[model samples]
Target: MICMDTTTAALTRDEIARFHQQGYLGPYTACTPEDMAAVRLRIDAEVLTSTGPNPASPLHSRHLDHRPVHDLVTLPGVLGRVRGLLGDDIVLWSTFLFNKEPGTPEVPWHQDIDEWPLDPPVNLSIWMAIDEVTAENSCVQIIPGSHRELLHHVPSRPGMVFSKEIEPGLVDTSGAIDMELAPGEFFLFSEQLMHHSNKNDSNRRRLGLSARYTTPSVNIRDQDSAPCFPGHACVLVSGSDTQGLNRMTEPPA
Candidate 1:
């Protein structure tokens, strides 16, 4: 009989080994069609009322009420993959509804851990695409195994390819993969990896729900605290062990 438990349903050995070697896995589909519909509805509500980009946009923070995005936080498969990476003592640290409208500028090349205040730098980001994400429309570019190396990079121009111009001496991105995700598909990656997205030149807008998870031992800073939706959310799913995972309280910051 097939075991239907999440912990045991963890990623396959090849998957785990690949992640260890490459530092990221998937385009994983965690949400069902119905779930995707619900998420789109919720995001639509925010889009309808929004005056500008979501707070987590790094460039804009207007009309930041992203409460409608709470569902992705409680998603089961997402939490499972997260748990498989970090073990059972997880504490959600932040959430952000990341969006890039047509003509949006290119995000600078940098590691997520560098932007946030954390020690030992062990955290994962789950980037969930709510719309079709393609290389033509400003897809995310990641350094395949850069998570193993730590490099310092200056911020790029608001809408320019900072990585291309300065990355030669700082870090090598030759084997990097430009991830293309569909609605309901997401990628989980470590914060140490060098990653950035180009300006969205496509006619359609590109939207992703980026959620950050940290171990309980990781300390939270006060300033960074206000940015993420506050509070702890625990929605029990399968298994006797909820270790290292649970629902997120805020949408991506």
Candidate 2:
């Protein structure tokens, strides 16, 4: 599958190899652009203004309460690729809407390993665009093969979206690639992959939803944690979670 719109999202050997070498894959179609338009309308009406489970973070865990968000999070084209990478058992530990309106500051150079917390510190994230993401609109950029090494992050500069960021000197900007994506399209990357979005330079807004997936084997810390607060729940997105190592919940009806 060379990034075509196919129901069977199984990866070819070459694709898997490329992912291993480069640390990311896609801009694959998960749903029709028209369908994403409908979802976007609902998100603007219901999700943007409403408070989710985490009061401090309004965009966290909308999949637990919003059916549309859950549907998009578990879309076959997207989840199938995840299943192809992460074996049979999968759990959606968290989903968050990343909306960057015009003037949204740069998200700084950082690996998600610093932002995302898990016992193993490994997970696949599918970031599906809700609004069309373009390089001018601050599309995510990544350094190929950067996931192989873990870098130190210091406190971020003022107006940055992240709390901590890798010092500019530590990252090699020469190989950075832009991950511009269309609405309903997504890319999968390891949590340790080095990625960031620049300041929005265009008038158009950029909105994307990132769903975090992992096998049930990884322990998602609960109750007063950076990744999980009280009332956190992980959805078994595919196959059997016989391990039951984390708190599981049903998707919204």
Highest-TM-score candidate: 2
Can you give the TM-score per candidate against the true fold?
Answer: 0.76, 0.95
- In candidate 1, stretches whose alpha carbon ends up further than 4 angstroms from where it belongs are 1-9, 47-68, 158-168, 223-253
**Candidate 1 — which pairs collide?**
56-253, 88-243, 88-244, 89-244, 90-244, 95-251, 95-252, 95-253, 96-252, 96-253
lDDT of 2 by residue, 61-106 (tens): 8999998998887877887888888987898999899999999999
Give per-residue CA lDDT, model 1, range 84-152, as digits (tens): 887776665556656778988887677777656654467877887877889988878888887887676
Once fitted onto the true fold, the runs of candidate 2 whose alpha carbons sit more than 4 angstroms away are 1-6
Error of 2 at 179 (Å): 0.9
Report lDDT (CA) for all predictions. 0.64, 0.87
All-Cα superposition RMSD per candidate: 6.1, 2.9
TM-score of 1: 0.76
Local lDDT at 165 for model 1: 32
Q: How far is candidate 2 from the true structure (C-alpha RMSD, Å)?
A: 2.9
**How many Å off is the CA of 27 in candidate 2?**
1.3
